[model samples]
Target chain A: MKKNPQTAACLLIGDELLSGRTRDANANTLAKALYAKGIELIEVRIVPDEHKTIGNALIDLKVKADIVITSGGIGPTHDDITADAVSAALGRKTVEHDGAMKILKAHYAAKDEEVTDARRRMARMPKDAELIANSVSGAPGFRVENVYVLAGVPAIFDAMLEEVLAAVPDGEPETVYHVTGEAKESDLADGLRDLETALKGLKIGSYPGPTGKGGPLTIVCRSRSASVCEQAALAVKALFTAQGKEAEIGQGDRPA
Target chain B: MKKNPQTAACLLIGDELLSGRTRDANANTLAKALYAKGIELIEVRIVPDEHKTIGNALIDLKVKADIVITSGGIGPTHDDITADAVSAALGRKTVEHDGAMKILKAHYAAKDEEVTDARRRMARMPKDAELIANSVSGAPGFRVENVYVLAGVPAIFDAMLEEVLAAVPDGEPETVYHVTGEAKESDLADGLRDLETALKGLKIGSYPGPTGKGGPLTIVCRSRSASVCEQAALAVKALFTAQGKEAEIGQGDRPA
Candidate 1:
């Protein structure tokens, strides 16, 4: 039976991200979270804090993937247009959600301060949207349809992602087995291609050394079935062993 | 006269990226390079190493932006489908470029190795493709029309980016001035909203404290014109002065 895996797309909204003022750590976090949850993060897009840009990208991703998660542009500022854009994209009215209002009011009330119009903007969401709790901050992320809007800051995004991921169902997680060897990527390519064609469903990746010295290749084998991954990895290791090259097996072999 | 700035988009390709096995640094590098070159990075997309997905996203981005740059999946491996996908997307036939083959041969020849079929795959590019020199690696990146393909590795990507960026003309760089103060984002919202409307084209961003403490807000003002940015920054700093809160002027206030 061909099992259809759940797929997700991330729409990261902010001008700073596009302008290189901010380096985004949210995509990796979301990708790892979704991977652990067995949801395929098929695509990720970083757009500016523009209304039409966010709305267009959100609408596109929501239609393409089962779940669409957005980060950034939801803060309390004129550039915080995610709430409005999301509302328009999902065909819902933007309103001051009572639950959000209550949370913000209490969060500010704790410090003996009143919720300002700017802070209250965090409470604005699509009508009938469900709130995703932010343990780090009082400003709650909201869910409209299949799209989840979360805070842009890494700390807040990470905290809110845990809550939103709770609703996601688990599946057969992809198994990745990396085999590092002191061999040229080209030397292993022929063997890898032969096995890659025979393996059918496994993905084989060959990455060269970081310094581009042509040695210290890392072969990554991935499959939904752990057995297939093991088989592919062993075959890759054997290729190295055959060439009298030292090889070691590990879980992940990606550069930081 | 309203200046229409040159815009670029990035398409990061690799299955490891989507699987959360690798954290991407290419987007930020590309963003910063484009920013310094006075070009606007309008959007960035990270897609898995799939032919159709890469092709579709490439076609879309190449049409929308003045330039489209792709990183990763052009290695000598079964999963390296970037070159073929880009070729198909640009309606060109994939062929072994003489220049790429020459480079690959000389690179391997220096190491006392012959260019194998797997190694030769790196030389495949769209017919009539222009080469982007990778100073660190033997495999040269290719350009098909407005699209520039580069290596996924940071050192190589950074090096190749410098070469690609050279061909792009300088534009009116966006001006960004940040004022950080110990004030609630909500408290400043009313005043900010007033100036935001009056400033017309300036983009104002309010970032709460990293710890979500509700105080210590950072107000970011941006415009294509530096004078407008100065005017907005002065007004924002004045707001902090009026509230007797210490505000510091800086260049960037984004979280890493």
Candidate 2:
């Protein structure tokens, strides 16, 4: 068994998210993107824009995972304190990065505008940071060691992630085999438990979902090995079949 | 200045959420619900179904806020390790509560079915737990001291929250005044910074949002005092008006 699978944690920093004023679109977006690259997002922590709180949470998340990514607080506003907070967490000083400022200036220059001090805020990051290029917007995110500080805006965050993902070494992506059937989650619980114990390194999840679309329940088998995933799926299908329920293998578990 | 607004931290547990197989609907739902009840949701932590991870995360969150609520992992399945993890977190032994067992049996009895061992798993909780009633589903959630363990399903979680909210003492609910205008977030950033400093204990947020629906950007003022919120809102409106933009004051920031 491989000891490492590339674990990551996300620190979602924003007062808007904590205040219930904004539904955070970034965590889910990052989760999907990271999963596609085979990085197991082990933990996600959402903290307000308070300086000490952000710093403390970042430190906590940093200790938990290999790559720690943060969304929000990279913008050009008072609440945008993610860079400074992350810097403080690492016991480093935040300074305006020349590369980031050049990007910001050019982005604003294209709009025939000067980069104001407010706009300049986007350039400030940890002193030893490497810029994460933003394709959607001009303002760039930064990387300090394994930590990636990203924009809170969905478009820019998504755009910046492509650059970040390019730098990360992808692990063995889990092979998922999803089977849906008439068998309820509880009906297959015992049999699924036995299968889970029997199959080493195979992760199984049973979801109680929509009724009319396909079936009432879904049993998803995921593993690093394709053969294990297939075996688990077949066993799950047999569990449903034993109970006189019809089961179907699908492309993926995302219900259409 | 009031120091304490009843604070809450949520621990969302599920492998499906981490794997990006499911989008978590509970955090936003709980955040809005808690906010409406005057509870400041200070932090949210999402951890997968691994036993130590859940327990450790739960213990960590329990220290950060006045109330800790957990969503997911209370089902009748192998992956439903939340109750056991939480029980272990508190250094308490897990036992099948008679009351919970009674509820589970009654629920199954209503469906003219016997409660299987798998169904019996729902009754297992920490020794010193109080039942949190579930109106939507028959299985009851448990509260261990300040920590409330609830269902992961949106509808069931929402229903269980009603009872949880009823028990929590309300804080001075933050009053929100939303102003939308053509002025960009950076256009008002410097002036908004002054307003934030001038107004003691007022929290302000600037969101870059949709155009054509109403306007380009939104300025939200939130404070425990309604008067402070109003003053901040008016100040924000004046800033937009100063920028030659139409500013509209509205009930809340949920865009129409």
Candidate 3:
């Protein structure tokens, strides 16, 4: 098993999600991205737009995880109190940031629309916080004491993550291999065990996804070590092919 | 602050989610449900179909959260190891439960298929575990100790959760109200302060969502008490409308 790396916790805020009205895709993406970056995503908490609940969750994660990233409550809507709650958690007054306000003013003005005080609320930040860049939207996210606040919209979240991830220290990048053709997963179970034993540090997992044609298994091999992951994957491929199972090696790409 | 409730955490397992193939809708739904049930969802961890990662996350959540629910990684596929990892966490050997086997046999027989050994794996559970009824799928979920293992598919997960929730104790139920047509959030700032001050146990949140015509502002009020929540919402409505702002009631039920 890989020793715990730098860990992170995520807090998702919204009511639409709780009512099963909207599905969330961010947690899964963030988890995969963090895993490849060698950051252990230890926990995720989803609370509604309740100030006390959000405040408590923030305080708790700050004590537990090395970093915390929050999404959803940063919007210009009335329910967006993630920033306020984060401020409460840090015992800092939520104040309008000049830079953020400037950006929002420019954005609203560029679109030739009035920047209502409600819209201006998007520019608020915790005391002495750095701004997280939002490439998808002009409304920037903020960071305070290791907590990165981001917008809930998927496009903005994905774009902001590129910058957020750049700031996070990398541990080990994960690798992957695709194996397919005429093999039941159990057929390779013994070989997988052998590989797991041979490469103790590397973690190998198989996924049987529906190939475009049909159900052909995609054996995914992952590890913190690039070399170890590749070696194990190749060994598995060689063994499976020799045993008359059609298996193929996939190109390695670190999860974003 | 409601003084921390019983801690709860979730473990989401599946390569479908990791690969961005299946957009996860369950995490938020469960988080909200758990929160309403009075379990403070402390953390949610997503792991692929790797034993070590799943096992580690399971152990971690078990120790951290008072109750833990895991979804996905319970299937006939070789990639599924939630049962094994769960067993490992409980320090119990995985054994095929006779009742589960019987259920699985009946399910497969209904579909006119032979129960393969791989299919039999779905019947495996840790010693002395109770089953979470799955009306959506024949493959059932399990609950043991503080952990409630559930299916990955959204429909099945929802069905199982209905039963699981009934068996579990209900937390304090929260009341929600909608206050709409507020001219500005700042207009209600003073009123919000007074209401929050008066309703000590209640939480007053203001959210201005996009009304259908993109003209009116909505103020949402939430509290554990129905009367308090209604009173707060009424106070905000009267205060805002007095200032020539359109103020009507809204809900935490729908996005403000």
Candidate 4:
């Protein structure tokens, strides 16, 4: 596992998403998974299913991040051209991988169905790409260089991500601490800025929930050093206390 | 109102979104609103709260699309550097808008709360930027050139978008038709390809829903011309019928 914090980008390809017909869940799922493994998801792009668009985005994102994970456009349809786009981006020929073919064949054979040409299309991959196991569905995702092309379906995408994450080396996970208070963000903004400046490399964020919520202002402090994160969390709590407000630490399940 | 289809992009800036701590609803809400106004949301980018990242992304997205809408990072916090980034991107100085200051002062005064400096920070906007009305919240979003900077909160973002959309010119709205069936996408892949080729300027997409759903396969046809979209939709339904599968038209409310 790599100790350094690695950067990741998510490329979501689907016309439905841009059309406002579908809200994407894959990016959020992938982001959380990558964060747990100490990888920072720096960028997320949602592009249409056009070949040129997907191919261009893949090329651009690969240059910007250490790893790029793409979801969608890997189905058995004409618009499902993610494989071809990836091949184009990598300057590799799209070919039927023997391992991917066997997986699809076995899955279909067990169901008493023939492997049709359209179904076989799912087996095609960029040359030199390695297959990523898809336990939930028959069609497997593939990795070419730092780009991992996964399924669009949320269930299958999540399942395949588990395997992908297991294979990838872990990076330096960030230690995070959450503090919630009744004070408005504006009331503590200056103090938060001072704390952030005093503690270098400490990232703090303030999220204000709706009024009447037990603690409307939730502050998140994250750093590679757990001690630094803990220290910053205390400082945040002190700011709320100075405002005559009660601050609770570690009450929220997620970061702000 | 512009008669031709206008391309738009959304730039969402926040660490919480990338951390999976906050699932973005602003982009989806903006996308849907823009679609109704005949604008095509071609790209959506979620970047971190870093100044350079946000500034660079804003410059890039503005070049590609006719309009760019950014949500998040416009709050009173250390991480809320979106205004500064936007100012840098456009090479404009940040200044307090008199109108925005009045709105913030009135809102806070009505609540019998003192207007703090951190709260006043929300009044800052890029030079030459016009304020967008925020009926839900006092802090107004600002428009600079083709870029519109909006709040991150879902309710506030949605409300501001309504005003922004109303001010922008309407484009040529695409007419969409949906057809869903039980047939597998692969079974109709070849037919879809043929239909796509036959209908120029028509965009078609295939989305497969989860199993056990009555109509798992949905076909979406979209075009500026209603007649053309309707014609392509019928072709899709005919393909499903040829496969001896029942194709239901308009069973779903949204496009596939």
Candidate 5:
């Protein structure tokens, strides 16, 4: 039976990432989390912190995927224009969220610090949006429609993601099986092609190690149906066997 | 004087990436190299190994960027469909290039192995493409029009990029200046907005560190003209000074 898998797209907004100053850790974290919940991360777009770019990208991605998650540009800085961008994209007015304001005010007051205007900026969100609790930092992330706006800092982004993921419904989890062999990718390409043609709704992947890594090739079979994935895995092993090679299951090939 | 900066985009192809199995290293490497060569990396798209999806994404990115670079899916495997996708996107026929075949043959011959059909698959390229020398591996990458096809292996990708970058012309190098202060992004947000309005053709960025990393905030000014960037940096320092906060120039703010 075919399963209609929910799809997700990531919009990583940061000029630091494009400038090669900061390596992205959020995409991989989100991709893995979404995968465990059976949500397919179909595409990831890394764009700068410009207002027009962020707004346009959000609109485009929202139309294509079931949900869109954006990271960065949510800090208390002049460059933190994600709230304004989301408002523009969704055609809503930016307003101070009551829940967000209360949380920020309480956190700052408890610490005996005055809540500055820049600190208050974090409380603003698109009208009619729900707040996504930020446990790591006082500033909460707000969700407008299908888009979730989170903090750019890695710690806060990851923490806010936990809350976001809990609120979304889970889809069919994908079953993945792996087989490793001493054969090269070229040796099994044709057979793998035929096997893929024979099987429906299954994906077969071949990864070869670099030279001096001892000619190790891994074939991975993935599908929503466990039986189909298992059968495809057997066929892959048979192909290697026919070529006078041994395909070992669970041989600990490097992930991806 | 405002200078039109050349921009580039990267299309990272692989299901492994979407599956959250492999963290991407090529985009950062490529982004840094492009920045050094004065080509701004405006966007990065990570997609799965599907042919139609890859083809459609390629066409879209090619139009928006002056140059496009794709990494991964050049291996001798069924899942390595990047060449076919490129062919479909550009409407070019896939053909075996003589130059690539010779390199594969010589590399295999030295190891006393026959050049197998699957191995020969690496030699195939879009018609009228120039061969990119793969010094690390025998399988060569190729260039068609403005797109450069590169291997997914980090070693091979880095080596092939050296050749690819050498072939492309460099643009005006962007001059960047930094000012770091104890002030918060909120403390400087208003001044930054004013400064951005006064200066044309310059980008101002504010980056704040996470909690316990202290209340350090960095302001970056970037422009093609060194004098403009310097003047903007001084103005930023003056803003911090007017707020009774010391803004130090070249205090080793992390390069973005």
Candidate 6:
């Protein structure tokens, strides 16, 4: 929003999702979180748990985006190869993280379950990686270079990211103003076009629906500067009022 | 489900999506549609209208993925440059498709709007492209080589894809069977492990969820073959019932 803002990309990994067995909810959640933090979400890619595919996508995103976050493929089963794939992509070796293992062992011991060799696989991390504390589950996430490797499961991933996002520097996220009134897009097209041309950096979009004196048109005006957003919203209101349209301008947030 | 199935990739082009100003409903819809048609959705990428980024992603996807479907950046607006970027990626010249131009001109004439020079931009297509008729909107889509380009808006894109998908040959898509019962993944861990080891081609994963039968797990059996899927589902059903757990079988559909 200020100058040369940092950008992030997301890589969703898993065969179950590709097969349509699982409807992923994390991508949208992470997108919303990053947007609120002012980090530009440049791209989102969903790939199967294949080494070559994941490795290639990671390398590609690394060259373009400032930060990359990956979710899924970190389980005890054979298909969970996120750690291994991350290591291969970064040209590093996979090693056991003692701290992660300690946490996992404690979790299993509390539940009175034997920590078998298969379960220990969850403790493995890429070389020179920092562990992200998982509050929902004992299996910790890891960060190598600018790539943050996280689990696939929703609950655990959300908890881990809550802590991870706290460490990221905040950028200046754009504020939004909304005005929903009964007006056809065609009726407001000229004014919207003129407003868009004048706004420059500010974005003015009209979503149209319904038909009547007050046609349903949801106008969103967004900008990095709060004053700019307010000014644009006021100008839009004035134009709509002049056209004998009813419109209310307010901050774009949940009504509740 | 067949061996070495044809791969498909999606290129979502729009600045609103990258800036977190819009939620992408097209990717999931396209993925589900492609799956039903037996086209393996290999990768999905969200790229801005920037020429270099779109060109690079298009080149990479075209080489790796057999079919590439792109949405957005084909409208009349100045920001719409998907056609130009795609042609650049393929090292081809941008040219106007006569048939598309005629249809667009007719549509504008019917609406009584002047077909300005800016509106004519929508008629431009890359050389050697085939038009994919749009049912909802008059702005036709284009297909060049293995790349299928559609509008970024959901309604128009969906209608255009439905028409285009009918022309493409259907490959074998993966199928699935769901077996849920009063069971525990840990309890079935060793047995499921043996089954996974025995079935080389079939994929069996256990999803732990709230069991209505006072149990702790819901195992999902998936395979490329319906027979294999049925066999896996039966085995799980028999094993769970024998273990004094209530189990039921269900079916699922997945893209190849």
What's chain A's TM-score in each predicted model? Answer: 0.94, 0.93, 0.82, 0.94, 0.93, 0.90
Backbone clash count for every predicted candidate, in the order shown: 1, 0, 13, 0, 0, 4
Q: What local lDDT does model 5 show for residue B6?
A: 90
- In model 2, the Cα lDDT at residue A80 comes to 83
lDDT, candidate 5, A155-223, per-residue tens: 889899999888888888888888888886777899998888988988888887654234778888888
TM-score of each: 0.95, 0.95, 0.70, 0.95, 0.92, 0.83
Over 4 Å off, model 5: A1-5, A210-215, A238-247, A251-256, B1-5, B210-215, B237-248, B251-256
Model 6: residue B41 alpha-carbon error in angstroms: 1.0
Candidate 6 residues A83-170, lDDT tens each? Answer: 9999998899999998888988998899887777767888888988899987765778998888988877788778878987898888
* Residue pairs with backbone atoms closer than 3 Å in model 5 (clashes): none
Sorted into a CAPRI-style docking class, model 2 comes out as: medium
DockQ of candidate model 3: 0.18
Error of 4 at B256 (Å): 12
- Residue B163 miss distance in model 6 (angstroms): 0.6
| Span of 10 residues, lowest total lDDT, candidate 4 chain B | B208-217
Better of 3 and 4 by DockQ: 4
Instruction: Give residue A53's lDDT in candidate 1 (0 to 100).
Output: 84
Q: Indicate which candidate wins on DockQ.
A: 1
Candidate 4 C-alpha lDDT tens digits along A96-155: 999999999998898898899999999999998899998876889998888889998888
Give me the candidate number with maximum lDDT.
Answer: 4
lDDT (Cα, tens digit) per residue for candidate 5, span B158-233? 9999998887778877888889888867778878888888888888888877541347778988888788788899
Q: What fraction of correct interface contacts does each candidate retain?
A: 0.75, 0.57, 0.16, 0.65, 0.61, 0.21
Question: Mind giving the per-residue lDDT tens digits that candidate 2 earns over A120-218?
Answer: 888998997998898777788888877888888877787888888887778778888888877767788999999999999988888886221224788
Q: Write the per-residue lDDT of candidate 6 for residues B1-256, one digit (tens) a residue.
A: 1233378888888766665556777778887787776778888888876899899989988887888889888866546688999899898999988988898889779888666665677789899899999766587999988899998778888888898788887878767777787664445555666776777578777665311112355566766777877888888777787778888787763112
Question: Candidate 6's error at B167, in angstroms?
Answer: 0.3
- Candidate 2 local Cα displacement, residue B46, angstroms: 0.5
